[model samples]
Target: MAIRDWPEGERPREKLLTLGAAALSDAELLAIFLRVGVKGRSAVDLARDLLSSFGGLRQLLEADRQRFCAEHGLGEAKFVQLQATLELSRRHLGSLLERDAALTSPTLVRRFLSAQLRHLDHEAFAALFLDTQHRVIRFEILSEGTLDSASVYPREVARRALARNAGAVIFAHNHPSGVAEPSDADRRITERLREALALFDIRVLDHFVIGDGEVISFAERGWL
Candidate 1:
């Protein structure tokens, strides 16, 4: 049946206007952009298929152009549209990172770190160096570890933090295993980071162990 043939109130486009986009299903939301579907399918069906194949919104957003284009009935024209839409959304979110805002709050710290380290497969230690006003001045990836701090360089981190004049630092690292718990080495490194940045008066506000869409805060646990 034509999409319009559905109960007028139940249709996505109509519902989006009347109730806002959040009221629609994921398939319905995608269909508005897709406009139509290929033979034997409607836009809703195609969107559901896409989400099913890709796992969900996160995986779909990260999917490569070739994979998206290769999907049944999806061609370069539609694939490019998809690509542009995804990139635009990503940039829009990234724009939220402010260079001079106070980040003394845990809510801001999670918002910044979660977006920065969402989909990595390996452990990456990064520093969000903030200015006096708490605005983000520099975001530096300090170390990449295979198993532990075997690869993280403390002296180098100190050097960069000093050079950047980072008034405060928020440390973030990822757990590829999807566990948000801090390991012994993680705590050790937090201690090391706490000591190293002290001479510069660079406060280590929090250390986050990010994994599987959740974040564990060392500060929140009274560890930092």
Candidate 2:
């Protein structure tokens, strides 16, 4: 049914005023942002079409600004509203990240690293910096090569961590061979880095060996 013809209590705009934005369905939320539809379609109809085009709100939010604006019914103005809404969502995610910086266990570290590792042809070692309360401040790529101590200098990593004033770190590197298990070289490098960073009071949370849709943690194996 068209929004204006729907029962007043069930309409998205009205319900938002009475029950808040969180109470609305996905289509209702998008419809409110969309405001109008093209030709014979209502705002809700256009919202449904956009959902089908992008595979739902999460996927739509992850899309590039240009791609969002390129949709047939989505002109620049409507796309800008969608982009602003998604930007607000990102800020919310950032706030959540800041409130809980601690990686806690290996599983959480793996979950966090999988996205960055999913598409890599070579090893990419990264350091995730955490604050005093264990909230993540930022992350940096330390090195990229075949997982070996000679390639990834512990001293260099230590220097960078000290410069950033990183309280804790969770190190991760992708395995091109799609094996999450650590190699002998990988273990040695992690051990050396752990020892070197300890002197600077930089706690090593975990070392992740990322595979395709999988990860192995050194700390979880009692190796770190």
Candidate 3:
């Protein structure tokens, strides 16, 4: 049956309106995005099928243009819509970070950085430059390539920190491999950055290695 044929309270849109977006299931949320069904299936049914085919919402959202467009109910338009939505969420997180002091809001920092970095296909190194009070001065991508220890330059990091007049910094890098475990190379690089920044009397507050689901922090592990 079509979604309209369902009982109003049972329908995805109605349920969302009555309760809240948080109350909706993944399939229900996706059904709202889909908005219409094809041929014989209801929107919810198509959403369920897509979720199953793609393995979940995250996988579907992260899917590349060609792979996403190849899906039965989705196409380039939907892919574009999804990407725009994702970017908006990332920017929202960034705005939140901008409004708050970075050190006082560790969880928010992790969430913002995780959302920004987790979906990248290639490794990226970023810095959250902070003022003396630990308020964020600027967030910048210092380098982009295969994220290994050797690829990130300590001098470049120092230069950027100096350029921003940052009193301290929180470094972050993504592991495209989805493993949050900090490798020995990761530790070595963190130490090197700490030493380089130390010469200018700047502190290396933390180094976060962003992985699939978890962010590992050198400071949290007492490795800093």
Candidate 4:
């Protein structure tokens, strides 16, 4: 049956309005984005098929424009809409981080960084500059590199910290290897950055290594 023919309580849109977005299944959430279905399939069924084809919601969202547009029932417009929605979520998270002390919401910090970096095919290093009150001031990608490594310059990081007039910073980098374990090089780089920033009286709050399924924190492990 068409979604319009379904009981109001059972429909994705109605359920989202009556219950909450979190109460919906992954397929239902995606169905809302999809808006409509092709031929005889319901929107939920179409979303389920897309998720299966792409291996899941994350993979589907991360798909390249060409790849995504080529999918049945999806086109350039949907791809554009999806990309916009993803960016809006990122900005919303950043705004929330800017309102609170960075360390006070460690889980939110991890989630924001993970969403920003986990899908990258290469290594990238970013810094979140914070004010004296620990509210985020700026987030920037300091360096980008190949799959295995990225060359991070302590001097550049220090300069950016000074430029932002930041009092503290949280460092983050993604491991394309899908392993969150801190390598010796990772430790060494963090120390170099910490020392360089210390010269300007700036503090290194924490360093995070983002992986596919885990985010390893230096402070949590007592490495900082």
Candidate lDDT (C-alpha), each: 0.78, 0.77, 0.91, 0.91
Score candidate 2 by TM-score against the native. Answer: 0.63
Residue 175, model 4: Cα distance from true site in angstroms: 1.5
Q: Which residue pairs overlap in candidate 3's backbone?
A: none
Candidate 3 global lDDT: 0.91
lDDT of 4 at 162: 93
RMSD vs true structure, all candidates: 2.6, 5.3, 1.2, 1.5
lDDT string for model 4 (1-224, tens) is 99999999999999999999999999999999999999999999999999999999888988999999999999999999999999999999988888899989999999999989998888899999999889999999988984222488888889899999999999999998899898988888898889899999999999999997999999999988
Instruction: List model 2 lDDT by residue over 94-152, tens digit each.
Output: 45555664664334545556655545667899988876666787777788877676788
| Model 3: per-residue Cα lDDT over 54-103, one tens digit each | 99988898999999999998898898999999999999988989888898
All candidates: TM-score: 0.84, 0.63, 0.96, 0.96
| Pairs of residues clashing in candidate 4 | none
Per-residue lDDT of 104 in model 1: 40
lDDT per residue for candidate 1 within 88-204, as digits (tens), equals 654554456662364544566676677667666677899888877777787778887663656776788888888998888888998978888999988987888798888778888
4 Cα displacement, candidate 1 (Å): 4.1
User: Which pairs clash inside model 1?
Assistant: 99-135, 100-135, 101-134, 101-135, 102-134
